[model samples]
Target: MEMRAPEEIEIGQDITPPILPLAFTLSDSSLHSHCSSCFHPLNPKIPKPKPNNSHNPVPIPCNSHCNSSLLYCSHHCRHADADLHVSSGECHLFLQSDTSTWPSELSQLRLALRLFLCFQKLGFLSPEFLVSGRIGGLMSNREKFDIPGRIREGGRIMCLARRMRDGRFGNVVGESATDEMVLCLVLTNAVEVQVSEGRTIGVAVYGPGFSWFNHSCSPNASYRFSLTGFIGEPGSLEPGFRVTPCGEEGTFKAWNGDEDKLTNGSCKYGPKVMIRSIKSIKKGEEVCVAYADLLHPKMLRQSELWEKYRFVCCCDRCNSSPLTYVDRILQQNAANHSTCLDLDHSLCVEEAYRELTDCLDQAITEYMSSGNPESCCEMLEKMLIESSKTEQSQPLEPSPSNFKLHPLHHLSLNSYMTLASAYRIRALDSDSDKDNQLEAFELSRAGAAYSLLLAGATHHLFSSDSSLIAPAAHFWISAGESLMGLVKSSKWSSIIKKSSGFNLSSLLTQRSGKCLLLTELELGFVLRDGFDVVCKGFLACISRISPKVWPFLVHGLPYLKDINDPLDFSWLGMTARHEAQALIGGCECEGVAYIEEETIWKGLVLFALHCLLYGGYLTSVCYGPHCYLIGHVRNLLYGGEGSSLSENVENIC
Candidate 1:
């Protein structure tokens, strides 16, 4: 079965009405901070002794029976979900005498339990659905999986889930393989509900209208979650209008919108899903969404899809011969020439690449888990320096120093994001003593630079492929925020004061209103212009300003010192012609005409604002205006000369 557009769908238009899930569960990590029923952020601050990365959630009324059982943001949410929660037998997992001993991986088990109870209530266990391995309009993929570890885990969960009536409060859940089937279905169909970057709160499984949509590496549609009450978003498309399920002849039975009997069920505050077109879709054409991230290389994507969904992706992007330029850039060894990666790489290049990637990945992972910023900074910078080596005199033997990852390499992109975050954390951890103040200042500066470079590097790739717009939106907004933070730093106050002659008060005042409505900007970016047009204008404008400000952003950062131009990646070329590829020829700050510190910051202000504007435009397309992400971007771009970046910054973090 697949989903097809019922009418012509324009880019950025909603493809489906907000549809409720058949079952869902808040991830164990998210249970304490987000409402169990609705996934709403909770209330009251529980200040930690140490500085923390995530926002302090507001607390709300929690579970009464057992504090560890579930959390709800409001009485209505609890009221809405109580019956389903109680009957699903999940409440027993936390109410038992061994409540404190519940497995940390209880989320999947709980989700599967909910599916079992809900389907049972809907009388959806008929042999007809089971024979096809698709129950409740969702694929079980039961036959696709044969791994012993998974089979053992599923058996264990089935045993533990036996609850009341059958395995009730005093007893423990499997009956005639229902639990096994539902667990497999959960594994096959659940979509992670990610509300923010690097944050996935839970998982949800929707019905036919959503589940039938196929996978595409180059997808035309994208989906976002709306975690709201029984009443979904105001002005949301009503059901049965935008899309229709295209069930294959004699292969899968189409749902006759046959879920009427299940309509009276509860969980009023469950998350709703709506799919939108990232690319235009014509009536009767199939609409697809990416089942996995698109940025992964073809091999990684195929491996992941096979492991999880049991199918190899033959999407056009994955099947392209000679490989697409974007794919080439993502996996290329930049130290090598613009040569094809045939059956083999030079012994030196291949080994160096493997060692460096492993080393870089390990450093990044350690930093995230341990928050050891200084060590992370040291290790990543060393790897970056190693990766950028350009010497034909290089030894034929394998060595870390000989390996290279271009700025646009996916791994390099990961390092940039980690470094940007690590530097900010290092700044946050520094003391206020005068000796450390300068260090903190540089740390902040480095963070902002990494963020900007990330945006620029990704923007360069985005100029080639408009489909990268989602990630492009995120990077640009992040860069804008970092720059805004830098400009407001006390370290810049004295310099900026002296450069009052370089005031952007006019821009701040004139564009404040227009910032909120992207259509009003001079570029009229996302709304009034095609992506190709915006890409050209953005790249041209950013390039002209990069030389003046890039050095200032990368100052004191060794990893970034050699990057003469962040937005123009032509500088990243083969080892033999490295000198010829040197456009700025080392840092441009020393060679370019002298500009005042104040003028440099003025340039930063202009740079940051345009990035935010461009990011905001891209975001409007990727996440429609009603999304919280769009609201956050609007607030970031709403500032004027007198406004503080902090005022709106908190909304995102």
Candidate 2:
């Protein structure tokens, strides 16, 4: 519960259970569709009852005084929201006595106006309120406000001031001062409240304490909004490890409550926002949350941070690659083009990079426009197939440039990622079409496995940088999800059993050895100048796959745990130690006084290969440990350190 020292936090930790907004408004576009209080879908499951002889349709309140056609999940939410903000006469000023207001009008004015009304209602509207500094010194991007939209926002605030003076918003601060404070508050403290799946619901401001928490690309803390905090048996908490709330003793809810009323959604609590740590924090470490998606490529992350919060991120990920991985690729392509190769059989790396970028970009654009993942997959496959043809037509000359710009480059890896995402979607489709499901299942497995192989060669596991962790995790999660689907569907059960004669142990060993060679080359090419980008990818991959496999590997499904500790197979814990040692050049090979960087990299690669191979084996063996490859790899890695290969194989069989 107290994770001040470096520690591993489990997945789905309830950083913040659903909490009511302190000061919030529904997005103008979403007001008509979502609940005013909970901000969840208004009619997510239930349908409107059809008109009948004995039934009259209840009219939705979309008329006079309610300018926006707002809805709520229940009558309780409607009243709770009204009592909190609306009934305080804040919205009344916008809904004039005679004239109706448009949704756009509300959208433009809501944020600034809410700042005034909420403060006024709370009796904090004095001129000295700004000077007092009690309200955490309202922080906003004053410089960014002045750059582009300052005048426009200034004009809008002035207009709102006039409306307030003329309407029921009685005796708020003077127009100019009000505009200044509101602009500062909106720009600095407001947080976007979106649906759990990512649809923008609205913007809301948290309490001063919540606002003080800073942003980090690689964040240590996170929160989720809810109307009520969850209370259940300690072991039954939703996702994440069971964490005792900071002030609470052993458990959250005492046992005096009724047994039938202990569900997460049925709990009663207040509107305060809760925070939880995503990872361990040292005593002096800054606790930060990502303001944007941490998995985004670096350039995109930086651009959003600057555009939204007006601060350029200097986080480790941002610092590791200022140009972003994609931008660097583009730059490399351009630079390579400047010096054209003159050799007859030289397959120009620059040409391949350019073609791949252009083709993938176009394919992504088409997918975005059409919303068809299948079409996107087809386009990428076609590009790869065509590239294969070109590579065959002109056999590659083994120049450094050719080797650097091989067909199976990082760009090709990106293409594989895209294809994997598409097939994953197809595999998860709820539709009952058996042929489609079978095709999707097969494609998903191939796509995920190929992506993992490509991921291994990308220097993702070369070091323990947090930036690289996310992408690798994303790929592995995709692969694991697809593999789970295959195991459940039993599509490959017969094939797997029939292929028992295949020397899988040799195949895995050979593959892992090749992976190390490819990793050496990639490290030489991309990370020769910098090692910051190395193991972040591998760490991320393990982070994602660990919890998914934990139930099987750690808890061991009622059998293996009887013989082993539940914590013994923690890949994250193992890698964390490995990462720490590698950072300090602690790698030791036999007879070497000090291992060189190259040797250290070789050791790291072999370790990562083992992790990947074991991860795949565990996922596959979850079907039942009778699969022959599992024991082979286990014995190969842990032999003499534990039991013999024959003994382990006998146990499994």
Candidate 3:
């Protein structure tokens, strides 16, 4: 859909039209949580009163084949879909095993079986519904999966097809319609059902008309998933998909509330996908939806598209170079409506890092808890203004010159984390006004992005000094805490409304966990690197903090070997201490050397300690017990140094 020049739009504007899934299946993980017929969540439509909680009604199942496992929103919807997919004998295959334990890949197989059943129900295949261009198009790994070998493993599919061929479903014989073609169609055309930003609830196959929309990395359009309200009328007794009212508790829970509920005396909700515009589209432009996450780095975005969708992204954003200091300075000045007469792009890398580091140092000094809040805010603003210019900068190739500095560089990472922490502290400041909280939230949001980007995708950071680990871990923990704060803030409702139909809260909450895991993984490496002298106290403190981090450390140590570095300490062996130790090194026993270094077990303590400390810090705001726990850990880490840990905890609370 295209628009004229005067037609301007903003984020969250519905893109004129919406599309519905042609055939959908719940993910194995979500099957137990949602009804099998209408795909509505299995949770109750209205909250049961406290008095009736113990007498809550049980849901009716689909059929004997899905008695305990499959559920429906209503008997009508259950019966409506029963003749098509479930009763046709496909549902029995899923029922034989524990449905909840099914692996994710089985979704594709399930979708294939359902499509075949739907075709049989219609008595014939419709040409309009089939995708053209090629067989198994855009489905990666077709060479391995889409084989004549399909028939070798066709016993179950053949059996199911035979059962569904009971004179009513097109009278199709066993050899009449092969399973390979149906499997190919499902594999090539299945669209992921995204329930929230960066999260998929299930996979669905759409009519060819719906699948024809092209993909874009910087898509002007976006989509959201919901349930169709009812069949035709509000109180009509017609059988259709049912939707539970969306509540205010979560972004997706409640509905618009304008529709009548008792229509048809049945609750019907079917899966619906609505496409909306994030930006205005000009006349003659194509409508697009992002097939992959836009938040991922360009290389990842392009690589996944190439591998999965068989295309390369030459999107403007991908083709463009990262913003340099000069580019940013000019943009910022232009946004401020300030003069840019002295613009210069000749800044070298060393000079750039030096300036950024100096700006960060000054900001850190002013960011102290002892400083005035106003002064600290000003300093933080300046620090962010300078450092964020580098936040998205990446080189085509890493070299020792200006291109070498990634966002994860010590100077940039520290600056971003410091600014983010300061903003969060101000946002939660007891004496601060609402305006301060708003501004703090904005800064926190941006800072958290940079922080997360640095830790996770900045692969270059993995080769840097071991000393950088502690600060990086601290930064990631701060990012997670700030995200949790946003999740709990009142501002979230408005944020959701303006979020281009994406679930901002869910995205942030998911990212918070990712940040924590990244922190744990990084600290695992740190503990392994500094096993003996440097990590002893850290390890001991952690064992008391939480014992859970130890297992992760034990499993994650081998991957943390800094394989990108030429001087990796682990595989290359640390410097020898004594002649006797070297001389008596090892007598080979079953292909193992008896030579000993510091016990790897000690590193487990250090890893667990930091994980506990960081985990506690992230939860300190609402979990008062964790507040005390983090406070103790902070005091343990810096007993006589200062009140940094306590101040951080206080700010978070």
Candidate 4:
């Protein structure tokens, strides 16, 4: 829809317009065409002569440019303009001039300034006419006319004058003069004259017509100054009445017949307007703005607005009570503390951590009471460090099953790893029962957790269909390093070896061997490029202690050929093949040297080869060739040019 223009005044039947132009002039002498007091064009018949006074009147020169339509002489003009006689109750005939009293001339001067300023601010004055009149009766004339009656009577006269000009009054009979008419009358009563800066020339006369706009602390219509003219609506200016509609029937109707006449039957109206959030209004409710500057905090804002506006606001922020304030303060403090910590000052870091711990405790209590798991989770992370430390030191025997681990201990792999390192460090420092037990417990737990992570991680690396094999392989390598640390730690070795024995043969028969073997396989795949060096070192150490467990080495060969997973498979396969060759080569040479030339050495060799192939004799044989040597015999068996027996016999010394 197109927006309407400003400067549009609605002239209803009861609406009244100002009859006199909002302009006037001042003079030094009893001017001819000028008013006796203001020195504008005065009505010739109604001469405002000076009152009799004991003091001699001072004579002042009149402006030469003024018209010479003489009523009063230059001497009278001078006496009337002088400050001495104008006060002293002697200027009654001169339109109530009392210069000695500040109210008399001072009020008029203020009124004139206001009118000039208004013209500067707003573009035009209302077109409706008003009658010239006086404000409150003079103290001397109070007994002559009833004060209230004069005010009421004067209001009625102005209303009639306005209605006559408008031609008709609308509906709603028996009402008082509208606010517009009342304003015009009030202006006439408070009219005054003013002089320019040097007092050499007169500027204009003005009145208090707009003063009836009232003083609302939370007023809706705001005034703004304009140099050109008033621009109404959003953009351009136009001619029409700027009426704000009322929702109720006859709610704005005039109270009296005189008022109705003044406004030409239009409803009583004032500058005080309402701005509502909705289009419709509710009964008995007064429209309002917040009355406070938007920048202030809620508490301060409400207090100031309530004191000045005399109404309590019910906004959501205002009604939130003290809890909101507390929460806001805490949040602000937290933000500030965090910023301080970011500077990396040690003191600030400690302080921030302490404050965060306190906040977490409070938040946890609140969240638990409210039964909000999400909020609880948020707080749990904040207190994770302290919680982990406390739980780790607590005795394990008496702990409840559900609460056996701290939240971090249960959830984060990092926490488990850290705990394991701490225990290992402490065990190295002290050999006490407490340290030993704690170390063993933590290491065992860490090992278990690492094992689970490694399984998931390695599966992703070695799975035939795995898409993220490269990245998974990288993760598996790192995980293997962590497990290797656990495997080689003095505390772990002491705990395991002391509890059991240094029997690789026996261990290979148990679940522990499978776990170790799987760990080795995964590590080999992860560190394929370094597998020969790492696996050779490991095997060499195991070989010196337990030579009987060589078959397990042979069993790992198939995994080398068939495993195409992206992890370091090549290095692992090559290392396995190299170890098999070494073991089989040792068996062939030794058996040929020790056995009699024909005493079934071939069967024994073949049996050793079979044992190497199947891993069945790994824990049984005490003195045998390296298990890897069997792979060479098998290769020879397959690659021999002639019969296997013929080639074997030729090779025998």
Candidate 3 or 2, higher TM-score: 2
Candidate 2 lDDT over residue span 289-385, tens digit each = 6787644456667788777677787876567634433323323322232334655424565455466678889888887687788788778766665
lDDT of 1 at 493: 77
Local lDDT at 596 for model 1:
72
RMSD of 3: 22.5
Tell me the lDDT of model 3 at 502: 26
Expressed as tens digits, the lDDT of each residue in 99-159 for candidate 1 is 3343336787778778787777767778876787778667788777877456445545544
C-alpha local distance difference test of each model: 0.67, 0.43, 0.41, 0.28
TM-score winner: 1
Model 1: weakest 10-residue lDDT segment is 576-585
Each model's Cα RMSD: 6.8, 15.3, 22.5, 39.5
Give the per-residue lDDT of model 4 (tens digit) for 1-653.
00111233211111112212233223334244443332333444533434663121222333322232222223544444333222211222232222233313322332233332233233322332212122211011222222444334433333332343345444322332332333333233332222211122232222222222222222222211111111122553222223222322222222121322212111111011111121122332332223343223344455664443333556544566542322122122211212233334445534654554465556546654674533443454434433332322223332111112122111222332233333333334443465475554344333323332322323222232122222222233333333333333443455345424322122222222212322232221222323234323332322231222122111222211121221222221111112322221122222322223232222222222222222211101110112122223333233333233221222211
Q: Rank order by lDDT, top first?
A: 1, 2, 3, 4
Candidate 1 regions exceeding 4 Å error are 46-67, 95-104, 164-176, 232-241, 250-254, 257-267, 337-351, 389-401, 431-435, 495-507, 510-519, 522-526, 571-594, 639-653
The local lDDT score (0 to 100) that residue 258 gets in candidate 3 is: 24
Residue 27 of model 2: what lDDT?
Answer: 74
